[model samples]
Every structure is written in C-alpha cells, then in structure tokens.
Target: GSFVLKAAHDAYVPAGQALGIDRDVFSKILDEKIAGHPNIEIVAEEVVSLDQVPRPTIVATGPLTSEPLAKSMAEHFGGDFLYFFDAIAPVIDADSIDMEKVWRADRWGKGTSDYINCPMEKELYYKFIDEVNGARKVEPKDFEKDTPFFEGCMPIEEIVRRGPETARFGCMSPKGLPYPETDKWPYAVVQLRQDNKAGTAYNIVGFQTKMAYGEQTRVFKMIPGLENAEFLKLGSIHRNLYINSPQKLRRDLSSRADEWLFFAGQITGVEGYFESTCTGLMVSMFLDAKLSGDEKPEFARETAFGSLLYAITEEEKENFQPTNINFGLFPPLTTDLDGKPFKGRDKKLKKQLICLRARLRARKVASYQN
Candidate 1:
C-alpha cells in the first residue's frame, strides 16, 4: 500500500520537466476554460460559517485560513484539531546583492547551476554563527499551540543549538563544492536560491532563523556575499497546525469520523509545495466523482499521488509525522538483484522502478478518466 513503487518510476524525469498537474496559470485558465461545465461553478466568496454553505462541500481553508472558519471546522470535526508550525524563509532582492562574493553554481556543478553560493572563511563563518546563536527569539502567540515545527524546517538557531558544527555538516557543508580561484573549499557556505519566476527575489538558502528583525539584519549580513544585502523581508518563525494524518485520515484523505470531509494541502501533514498541490488535485478528483454519482476516485498504489497518500494514511498516528513526496513512501519492488537483499542505495533504485510502474499506472488512470 505504499507509493515508492510510483516515485521510483518518476525518478528519471528529465531536469526542468514539470510533473503532476500544471498548476501555474492553468488553474485560472481552468476557471475560465471550464467555466461552462454544467455541474461546476467556481464561486469567489469567503464563507464565514460552513453552516451557511451547502453540506457535502469541502472546507479546505488552508494554513492561513480564517479564525472563525477554523473554529467552526474544529467544532465540526469534534475533539481537538491537530496542528504544526510551518515557516517561510526571508526573500532577498537580487539587484541589491553584491555579486563580488557570491558565485553561482549547483553543488558539484549539477543541472542548472542555479544556486548562489556565498563562500565563507572559518573566522567569518564563526562570527555569523555567533550572531545566530545569540539573536533574540520571539515568543509565539497563545493560539499557536498545536503548531509545533517539524524537525526538517527547524530554524538555523535550533540547528546550531544541537552542536556548534551541526549546521556546517548539514546546510553549510563546503565539501565537494570548492572555489575555483583558490582551488580551496570554504570553511562553510551560505546559499541563496531564486524564490520566484522573475528571479527578482532569492532566499537565504539554508538560513531559516527565528532571530528578531533587528538582529536578523545585523547578523545575516556578516556573510561574504551579503555585506550590504538588502532584505525584502526578514526571517521570523511561526507555528502551524496539522494532524497526524496516517492515524487520522484514510488514503482517500478523509477523517476517521467524518468521511465526507476531505483534507488537503499542508494541513493534511504532507510537506512541500508540490505535495500540497497534488493533494488538492486528488481531492478534486475524489470530489468530482462523488458529485457525478460515480464511485470515489481510487488511485493506484503505484502513483506518486498514491504513494504520498499511502504514507499519510498508513503510518502509525502516534508516531506519524509530516512527510514530503519521495520514493521512500512507495512499496518496495520485487528486485532480482542478489546483493544485500535490496537495501540502502539498492532500495533507492527500487523506488525508481516503482515510480516507472506508477507512471504507467497514471497513463491508465488518465485514459480511464478521459
């Protein structure tokens, strides 16, 4: 019941290729293009109360969803709603960045040398670390209790707290990536990646921090590329709410008690932008079938969407945590490889195989839908 088989198949998609559904402007195009669908009507209105709307409708009031709606949702679901904190990294203006110290390269020169690397000497790196560790942390508001952060997106200071060198080994490690001029590796590296389509904004690559606004400005500029860095937005932390979906929701993404209401996006415990969008599509498909008097959409266990759904719907709830769409969630393939019974890197390859199977499965699903 895992989707690793599906993700394994998707592993070899060519670089720069887009997968899943085309979500960009297509969604608006869909709103216009399909505006004439007999059963479909897209309404542009905020529902202050779910009771005011029709029943059997979904309340996908995402993370920034309104308080009244959120409260109404909690009450309808009964018991307490689960929550987790999600963070957004600060955006930096491209023109303001000093290109002298920042070099663009993909680590090891992989596809699309798209990342901006800010090389750091040991002394300078330590100073940056000192400021990060000493920055003032904000106190979260009372309504944010259910929004504890997941380990993957923990702020830079939290990583620093683990050990002095934890961040270097993780986000800032300079191994394999070296400066061409000196043929020497930096002691640590700060990276920035373009945040939007126009490339006007870039985010501090691995520099998610909870530092106060004044301190974030004072500290982060110490890096080589950012001595005069102008910040479009400062980094800060906030709590997000989520449920342990594996224990709470089914593969159809419905709660145990209220099967009619489906969960989607980050709130369902799937991480990553694509993962959230895919869930929304899946929910749309599921609801589409229901509205058409057809059976609920049943995704093949071999698809990426299927794999992610399996992970969220199948893990132990108490121990279940948020997961991004990856091959690991797919079921292992029956490999003929004799070495070590298919583990480690071998397992990774198997995931690719599963993804291929998923692709084929998706083609079939598409054909059936058509």
Candidate 2:
C-alpha cells in the first residue's frame, strides 16, 4: 500500500515516467471511479430490506449500518458479525453560524487558519463547563456495554466530567493564540472547521458528545455565536461491528463459504487508518485477478500488506483485537547485530527500515499483476 509508484519508478526506472500514489487519495479516487461507472448504480438511500436489494451483493454498510441490515447480513453470511461502538462528532450548517462573532485562526497561527475560533469569556466558559458536567447521558442497549471512549477522542461531555480544567487541557487549550478584543488569551475556545469542500457545513472539532439530541441542541446553543446555530446532525455513540478476521476471513479476504464476497476495512478487524486502506487494496487485488481469470499473487510475510493481512487472518483468534502495524507483526530479524536482535540507532530507524523492506516487497507483488 506504500507503493509510491512515482518514488518507485524514480528509484528504479527512468525519470518523467514516475507516478507516485498517495494511497489515501488513491482510495477515494477508486470509490469515485466505482461510483461513476455506467454499469454501477450506487444508491444514496439505505436498503431497508433484503427484498429490495439484488442478489450476489457485497454489503459494505460499514459501522453505522442499521440493525435490520446488519442482522440480515449476518444471517446470510451464516454467523454473527462481532460488534463494537464508535462515537461520531456533530455537524453544523455553516450558513446558520454568526461568523461576525467568530474569528478565523489556528492556535498561535502556527498552522493554517482553517479553524474558526468561538472564543469565550472566563465567566461564560466556566458556566458552559459546569452545564456539560451536569448533563444526563443515555445508556447503551442491553447487548452493548458502555465503554470509556478512546483517550485521544473522548466526547466533550466526558472531558467535562473529569474536572473543570479538563476541557482546557484537552480541546480548548489556548496555548498560543490571543484575542484582540481582550488582548488576552481566551479561557477556552470551541473551534469549528469546514467539513466539506463546499464549505456549507462545519464540524465541532473535539466536540463528540453522548448527550441526548434534544439536550445537545439546547446546550450547544449556549455558546455566543451558536445562539441560533442550526445543527445538521447531532453527535452519536454506537457500537462498531468487527469479525475475528483470523478466524473468519481468509488471507484472500473471502469467507470460507462464499469466495465471491470479500471483507475489507474495520469489519475485517484491520484496525487504524492505513490498515483499513490496505485491506481495501488487498480486496481489490484479489477480486481483480479472479475476475480477469488470473492466478492471485502471493504476498511475502515480510511485506507490510502481507504482514498485516497475515496478522489479522492468521493470528490466534481468541486473543485477537484490532491491531495497528508494528514490528511484532512483521517477520522477526534473525541476526543479532550490535549485541542486539537488530542493528539500528533507535526504534525510529528500525521502523523506517522495516517500512522500506515492505515497500520493496509490495512493488515486487505489484509487478506480478497484469
């Protein structure tokens, strides 16, 4: 997946013919290409019932998919899909914002001033902080257990519950920027940023919340500029579904029963940002070969994609949870260089070398493709 085609071509082939690929942008382009094809009809509305969908389908409804569809998918696949919950941030209509009261600035003006700062007076910030602390939360369904959200991505309400200064240290840390009006840094700032290319909507950065929809709108509006803000969507916490990939999905990403259907991304238990994208690439490669009547290429266990796929699909199933790419997942070094297992000045250098090896292996695999 780190096959920087341009870098590869530049390193090995002639100049000007090199074409580098940003895997993230490449994946989105693939999605758009698949959506735009004449033979494909991507539906905007959710398929409420299986009766409405066509046969021989791939149900990639993702984590936020509905219960009925999820159940149907599970039933058809001949087993239950493992589930978990994820909290989502709320979206606000940009047009509804009173931008006159907000200023555009990045903290300390270090980064791009992409963020719209909604500054708060010391008194107002404290009051809002207190309200979040006192807000009520709804419990999850019986099958779902309430989990502490990830430390880096905790909901705003959760942060407030920790203490009065929690939000300041986390989301509202006014370390760098100063307010012109007061000539003093704000006590806290609720930053909003453009969510889409059109700039018609913005997201409440670090404002993920478990508060009831009704309560969310009421309390959020207490912010000065958001007094009449229109919420496009409220924040929600939900369980995410994941199968034990080592036990369920094969190395080819297909289940034992139906080879035609493939699992990719988080549903297959490939965790983290790049893991999901790598899974998608593997699925595409597997399917492309099968569709074209060619033998699928086997990836080396030492390769990045290969190591990750093997880790997810070949690891001990019972002990399995989501995993990010790490040295432990890769085939270990055999030599004891410099009185250690491997030779490197530090862990960072070791990882860089491992990444380099993986990319070379990926290029070799790609060369085998038609």
lDDT of 1 by residue, 1-370 (tens): 2232233233322222222222233344445545767887788788876577764665566666676777776776664666666555677888888988778777776766677788888887787788888888776677764456766787888788888889899889887678968778899888787665556777886677777888888888887878888899888776565666776677777767676777888878778766877888888788788778887776777788888887878766565567887767776665433423444566556666676778888888878777
> What is the Cα-based lDDT of residue 227 in candidate 2?
86
Model 2 TM-score is: 0.66
lDDT to native, each model: 0.71, 0.71
What is candidate 1's local distance difference test score? 0.71
lDDT of 2 at 198: 54
Query: Model 2, 1-370: lDDT tens per residue?
Result: 3442322332331111222233335556567667777998766886865456653334455555687876776775678776554667788998888988887777766555777788887898898988877777667776676333544456888788888888888788776657857667887888886665456677787888888888888888987678899998899886677766777677888866667767787777766656776787777778787888889878888797888889888877564666667688898654332335675467777777677777776778778763
Off by over 4 Å in 1: 1-44, 142-147, 333-351, 364-370
Candidate 1, 48: how far from true, in Å? 3.2
